[model samples]
Target chain A: MRDFRHDHSALALNTATLGHNVEGAGAGWSPERVIDACAERGIGGIVFWRRELAGRAAAIGDHARRSGVEVIGLCRTPFLVGPLAERDATAIADDFRRAIDLAAEVGAPVLTIVTGGVAAGTKGMGESLKIVAERVAQAVPWAREAGVKLALEPLHPVYGGNRSCLVTTREALDLCDGIDDEALGVAIDIYHVWWDGDLSRQISRAGRRILGFHLCDWLAETTDVLLDRGMMGDGVADIRAIRAAVEAAGYQSFCEVEIFSANTWWKRDPADVLDVMVERFRTVC
Target chain B: MRDFRHDHSALALNTATLGHNVEGAGAGWSPERVIDACAERGIGGIVFWRRELAGRAAAIGDHARRSGVEVIGLCRTPFLVGPLAERDATAIADDFRRAIDLAAEVGAPVLTIVTGGVAAGTKGMGESLKIVAERVAQAVPWAREAGVKLALEPLHPVYGGNRSCLVTTREALDLCDGIDDEALGVAIDIYHVWWDGDLSRQISRAGRRILGFHLCDWLAETTDVLLDRGMMGDGVADIRAIRAAVEAAGYQSFCEVEIFSANTWWKRDPADVLDVMVERFRTVC
Candidate 1:
């Protein structure tokens, strides 16, 4: 078990958290700037995002090594269901291969994956799940050979149809078992699973299979499904209790802050955002 | 099995769909106006909201009967657990009693009950479920004695923490069985259960225990958990298919249109709302 309380050295900036509060040119700060900023902050770990990894891989890897920042995990290879599955298979495979190479180069341990949602042109959600499971099983060998763990992240049921096929921790574990390899595991995001009826049991079941842990609060009145994430200590989730449960489950990974807030946080100052994240990480998270 | 293809006579208008659109309003449209609108349109059934019944139950009942409108179902009795449970018990019982009286007066057959979210002041979600089960069990005898069936409506998992203790069809049916009363059953709302992986099997399991069927589409990109509901054909949900599934489960009831659209439907002319609803009820729902 790792002691994260000692310093920000154990903390991983998901980049999305910084992106949540700071807009640069496109949406928020560019991925390159996000990486540079984290490096400057003496942040311990950086979880690179797939969409932002293409042009800045070498720069990020070199900077992280020079500055002693560990790239802990990659943001994602989206789940293997829906339109993205068949229509963009080759493209997905290429991106994933690149993601694996980048992770290996940057010393990131895992590539976080959200199993894709129902096929855009279909009416069956269960059918989508089956397709996703099958595709994941097929993708396991490449991941294992690359020496990068494939961390399946189960999103909330609210996103059941359009975002991700996997909606429960137990279900993610079940899929991991089907993959039947060391490379396949889970990225446990508290925002997505805090309300689960089987949460405590599932967290315990996750054990060492929890490859990563993401933190964010679920507000009492959520306005947007994708962007209205609350910061830690801002919502109803018992963060300390959840963290204790995760620790008890044998997961000693970096606590990655991932908040997607279009309205509230995005308008704040970047320095203010990092300061608050550090403060919250120390006390609340 | 009532054919709504030719007219809106088989459709019941859940008053919340129209009346409770704008939050924090002193009062929008009167219950009498809602009743008159439904009656003039020859709508077969009008689902009465409890909020409307609080002060003017007799007047609404008389108006409905005089206008030859059938009250198909009572809107709700909200229940959760712990402090809310104790606080809501008297209020719920009083509300249920009043709802039953209103139903009797207007010839309504069922009263919808929403088992609330995890207890606020005490107990976890699981414990809250137990409290809700016990509370509903205690309320069942009164419901049976009053000859008004109590229909438990399971909300979506998004409302897992703060809105409803029950969030699945199987869970609601289990609660019904736990209560052990013929008067207790479930109201199957497509908006809440369409994304459920076990939806078809659970709806089949519901059988004749399905007391009512409510229709609303879940938008692909929902902005709000409570009010961003889509009109029948505009969203991702297969409303007609779910309706068919419920009907196959032996739910011989009016197909109720219940939407809470803050941005779209509320801003439209009320008549336009009904016009679209009736057209969709004919072609889509």
Candidate 2:
């Protein structure tokens, strides 16, 4: 395993971890401030959410690059095909194309895909997954044109019903197989997949198709499924082992810290949260 | 699939659905009352928790049988191994034996095993699962002697850390394969596995080794991961499809209704809860 105790450059900040996803949640740090703070800490990269980027993708991308930080990726496109997705299929396709364009404009190598939860009136995940595959297939041309990859992030099963039907790395890979687009891959997040018994095998199968890797902890007693993610060392996940597996599978990218602790870390100073993330990245993760 | 609408004879009430698991949660209906209520409604069977038995397993079992209601199964044995398991291995083994004796005394054919959460100081689920398999292997002799089958229930992956390390039906079957004992099998619960993409395949693989089948719904916007389980039909799970798969796999056992709805069902009258369960079991499941 690569040693992280003395090196901090591989650490990346997923903007949502600083409370960018939820309205009125964290320290409300601006994208510029977040970038400067990460750069000040010797952090190597930042993944921005669409909501935070507003119309500033190009400027933010340039700012991060100037600050010696890579634009790791984007948070997500709106649900491709689920309850939250645009009702019209064309709207969904247009929204996805715009996201790919944004990824290209921002110089983000990957655009994370959190395929929305069960489609309205759908009885099970099978139908919704099929819809997701169809939509991703349609968007492949745009993604390839933009020179950006679409990283399907399978949320935890807890989010299967209403958040994202894509709930496992294997399922994500299966979707990738059907699409068969070089621009499509997976973003493996420990919080959503640490419990998976076949995680190691799936990671190995993913290999170079692993576009991004996320870091966070699963609290022993998670009070809230969506917002109560623990900081790396504060929970029971075997971070080092999972990272070793990812690295062994040829993933040599930023280890993005993507916590959503509403009550704890999010309540602290943004600088403090960044400092702690860097510390844990070196010591725990 | 069997028509639940006209015939609830295949329906089994798991006591926890009435708030038996949490203290001061459900209407304080006694076991005798629960049995009589099920029989009156033409409900087929009832599954009791160990706590409710309170040394009266024999009498309750006899009464239920006399009332034409089967004692389908037992709620659980204390976790065989994990963070919540007893530190002394012998104690875990002894507790399991006692649980088996209770299941036999109650005339229940199967004892549900919720193999516990992550083991203390364990970094990953692999080590904890091995411990669970070893412990279950040790208790197989006692289970066989008591004429009771141990049904390993794999909880949702959300509970992998503090509730159960066994988080997939596939993983549960793997444990059964390791033990290779006729006394061991799996309990397939919809709430724990509706999101599994390989659900149908795993059910087919389980075949006759499926000792029990549990029913419940997964609410689209789940508020609580542990206690906010939905009643059948109230959530988005394809209960009938899953039931079809289980029945196709040669599982002729009762469809056990086991919801842990702290905010909704538990607050209702016990009779009202039972009535709703029957209504939904017929219409939704």
Candidate 3:
């Protein structure tokens, strides 16, 4: 395992921790400002949401690289299976390829995909997953052509109903294998998978297919399913242990910190949040 | 599978849907009133929370039986492995045995247990589950002697951290096999497990060890994790499909309707809720 104590070159900020606290009327921080702030703190990388990119993907990528921070990856593509996703396969494929194009333009090595909820007119996960797999398979060649990896992020099961049907690391890996492309892999998020009893075994199964590693704590008394994510060390998650398992699985890459704390951390100053993330990275995670 | 469209004699009500509306100032319904209401609806069985019994277990059982309503189960024991649960093995055993004795006194053949959250100081579920297994094993003999089966109710993963470390049906079955006792089994609640991709296979694996089957729906836009559960046909869960799997697995028993809807059903008249439950069970489930 690589030491993150004093050397945080492996650290990455996922911009979402700031949430509405960034770039809104009350808060004025452009993409360049966020990148510069991260670099000033010795943060090695930054991942941006598509909404913030706003068609300036290449410019933002260049600015981050020049600022001594890598654009680790893009936040996500549109939902591939839910009501928010495209209605037909052709439209879905077109939407996915567009996201892949953005990832390529941004010079991001990976494109994260939060698969949407249960498919319409479907009974259970079997058909929904089939639709996801088929749609993902269709997008693979374009992803490879752009030199970007498709990272399927299996979200927490709570989100399985409307956000993403993909809800397990093992399930994500199976989808990757079905596609049979080197461009396909998984992004392991601690928040989504920490409670899984067979996490270590599944992490072992992930091995080199891991495209990204995400950090966040699962607050034991999580009030809101979508927004009550805890910052590191503030919750009951076994952070160091899960990190060890991820490291042992050979995923010693950009460890991005992504917390969607609407009621708590998002209300704090961005600088303070980053400082605490770094401190917790050294001691707790 | 057993032609539930016209006949709901297998239906059971787990009184939590009534929440505080069942008893309190302004609510005059007693335990006997609830039992009589269920029997009047042709509901074959009913499960009661421990607080409502009030040391009159035998009396309540007799009252329900005379009204032709079976006392299917007690809602739960105190959390088996949480902060609220007894910390020491002896204390935990004493508490579990007492609950088992109560189940016997109420003539309930099964006791549903909502295993509490991760063990107090434990880091992931490994140590917590071990503690749960040990504590449960210690009480199994007592449970067997009382003719009550200890049904480990693996709650939704949403409740894993602080409500129940036992999350997945597969994991619960593994624990049951490890304890290796006839009295040890699982209660499959649709609200907790409908999102599982491997539900059917796990249901098949459960086979004869399915001590109970609880009904409710997973509303797609679920606002509250514990409350806000839907009626059978109102949510995204494939109720008929899941029932097919459970029935195929040999769980042709009293299917309990256990909805903890603080925002919806709990606010309505208990009679109306039971009427809707019977209607949904006949049409959807």
- Among these predictions, the greatest lDDT belongs to 2
The best-first sequence of candidates by TM-score reads: 2, 3, 1
Q: How is the predicted docking of candidate 3 categorized under the CAPRI scheme? A: medium
The C-alpha stretches of model 2 lying farther than 4 A from their native spots are A22-26, B22-26
Off by over 4 Å in 3: A20-26, A86-91, B20-27, B86-90
> Which ten contiguous residues of candidate 1 chain A have the minimum total lDDT?
A18-27
Best by DockQ: 2
Residues A160-234 of candidate 3 have per-residue lDDT tens digits of: 778888998888988988888899999989899988877789889989998999999988888998888988887
Clashing pairs in 1: A24-A28, A79-A115, A79-A116, B79-B116, B116-B165
**Cα interface RMSD of each candidate:** 2.7, 0.8, 1.2
Tell me the lDDT of candidate 2.
0.90
Q: Put down candidate 1 lDDT per residue, A22-137, tens digits, no spaces.
A: 44622466655666667777677778776666666767767776776778888777556664454676666666676677777666779888777777766646677777777677
Best by TM-score: 2
RMSD of each: 4.3, 1.5, 1.9
DockQ value of candidate 1: 0.33
Question: Order of all candidates by DockQ, from best down to worst?
Answer: 2, 3, 1
Model 1 lDDT per residue over B59-94, tens place: 777788798787888877755453344474677666
